[model samples]
Target: MTSQTEIRVLEISPPESLDSPEAELFHGGVDVEFAIAKQERGYTDLCPSAEEVLVSLRSQKYYKKIRLAAVAGLAGAPRREDVLGWASIDLPRHDNLHLAEVHVAVRPECRGRGVGTALYSAAEELARDAGRTTILAWSDHRDAPSTRGDDDSGLEAEAILRPPTGIGGVPPDDAPTRFAVRNGFQLEQVGRHSVLPAPIDSEHNSALLSAAEQRANVPETYQLVTWKNRCPDEWLEQFAKLRQKMSTDAPMAGLEIEEEDWDGARIRDEEDRTLAFGRTSYVTAALHVQSGLLAAFTAIETVARSTEFAFQGDTLVIKGHRGNKLGQLVKAVNLARVLTENPGLKRIHTWNAAGNSYMLRVNLDQGYRPEDVEGEWQKRLQESG
Candidate 1:
């Protein structure tokens, strides 16, 4: 007979890192759990590299600056080797300081026994203790019931992101979805996940880019500037402005997200962290030729070991600069750069608001294919529990 799962914190003092044996165990456990989750999602790839975990949670170079805390729970016992699941709260130093993002995973065999709930409870306590009132979390699943736009075969139609009403108080169909919903969190935003095959066929990609270029009729008054790792010192101020615009201008739909206050210093801090982790970043931006102002930008990140995929970060074209196809131009420029630099990278993954038809069309035109849907959930800790 299976034993009852017991959940509690796997605590380690500060100045500690996830590279420790206990952390590694939990890290490896999470990888195994992710593998199971992916298989369930019909994905064939392995979980994203454990290196990302170590870099995020264990990098002392990022300690007080980022302020990350981890907690793990065990099943039926308080042993390091018995980790049933674990969660981490990432409090980014520069932005979203008032917010904490909880990332959790449970071992495949120990799921459905409240192990995930236990980890979340522990994480919530940590957030509360840190004086954080805003908590953001996400749930991912496959084969979920499609809402209105679904075909008879259950394939979901393009969903438009709408403002959330309130916590449904209704039970969700899956354990993962229910964990957050039952805990009083409201679904704030919906995103569609898509992937673009990498090691891009240069001939085909060139054709796509040329087609977009022709259609954009990008004004002769604009020019493309590309870089790696960080923007030029001269461009940091305008670049920061674009980032702040992303917070409010991007389609949040119903999400109650506050504006992200980005500046040159914060941008520098991010670049430093990226350098410490030995990752590669590509940025492509449109410079208004005569004005010398940055009109829009797009970026992609990949680690040296990222042979399979690169994470697409942000692509934005300011309001006044819209209609120039700057979005497609910048994204296409960066995609070509990433393909050239990281020849082994075979795919690029990005998530977009379900209602973002403009950006979605841009991605589709660049050969991106829809893969899944995910929710960005939000909880006001003080109001709930």
Candidate 2:
């Protein structure tokens, strides 16, 4: 026989206790139903499964931010005792330690009974404990009405409702545009998702390479070379400078974000972390001859998990220097190398902001296309309340 306990907050530890059939039933079962309900109401594909949820919970990036919750009731009704929701809060901006990003989720069975409210309240308390004063939430709004085959808009509508939490204001339209207006969250930015299709013919690849070769001539004094061997201390210094300069020059809409400070210690730490994950299979760097300038570089790490094949992680490139088509040149060469080295690799995936047309053109010319679109929306909790 299982004992019953009161509903309260508890600090669960690693090696999650929710492993038994009863616990898995509570977690996975509720999640499956929640997804179907959301889908039926036109919420589309918004739910995350237990495995994915576990991954996010365990991720190094999110380990410090996540808060778990469960209801405590009778044994047979363990489903009623199951943790039906979760919230994660990111650390504050380095400059302003008082602000943080808050992510929230609630099980369908627990909705309307104030599960979101409880989860959000607990999140804010956690934030305050972490020395944060404000929370930002992100949600999406689709233009078309849900073709979910059900007219449960009313129930589906409550998904975005964020009542006054007293500690902070909820920005209106933090939910989708429609629900935001209906419930009170306001829209702060107009965002869109776009894709660059994969290149299909030799003509497309040739054009991309040509553009890059032409751009390479702009800085005639600089020589293009792939990054090899240990990165020299001087090279790292130049790379850091270029990184900051490009970040400051990149186009931003309305937001007054500043370039993040780069330091050698931090760079070393990141390098150590990446190496711990796996060995780097591909790295490309371009340097100037006369001034020893590190103008452009790109790195691709290949992950081989299954016997069938492999895929490419998104390639990172500094801005400003990209227009000369150096991005295309660097990426094309890197992709060709990967294909030649690893046979039977079918596809590659990458993502970019919808407004970034230049890189989109490069990827499209290289035979890449949009596989998926992830939306980003922000709401100011201080103002919304």
Best by TM-score: 1
- How does candidate 1 score on lDDT? 0.68
Q: Which 10 successive residues of model 2 have the least lDDT summed?
A: 162-171
TM of each candidate vs. truth: 0.82, 0.62
Number of the top lDDT candidate: 1
lDDT of every model, 2 decimals: 0.68, 0.48
Q: Tens digits of per-residue lDDT for model 1 on 313-358?
A: 8899988888877888888888888887777777788988766889
Q: Write the per-residue lDDT of candidate 2 for residues 83-194, one digit (tens) a residue.
A: 6555566663344465566655555545555555665667667776776655555543332122122222344433433222211112234333333344333333332222
RMSD of 2: 8.4
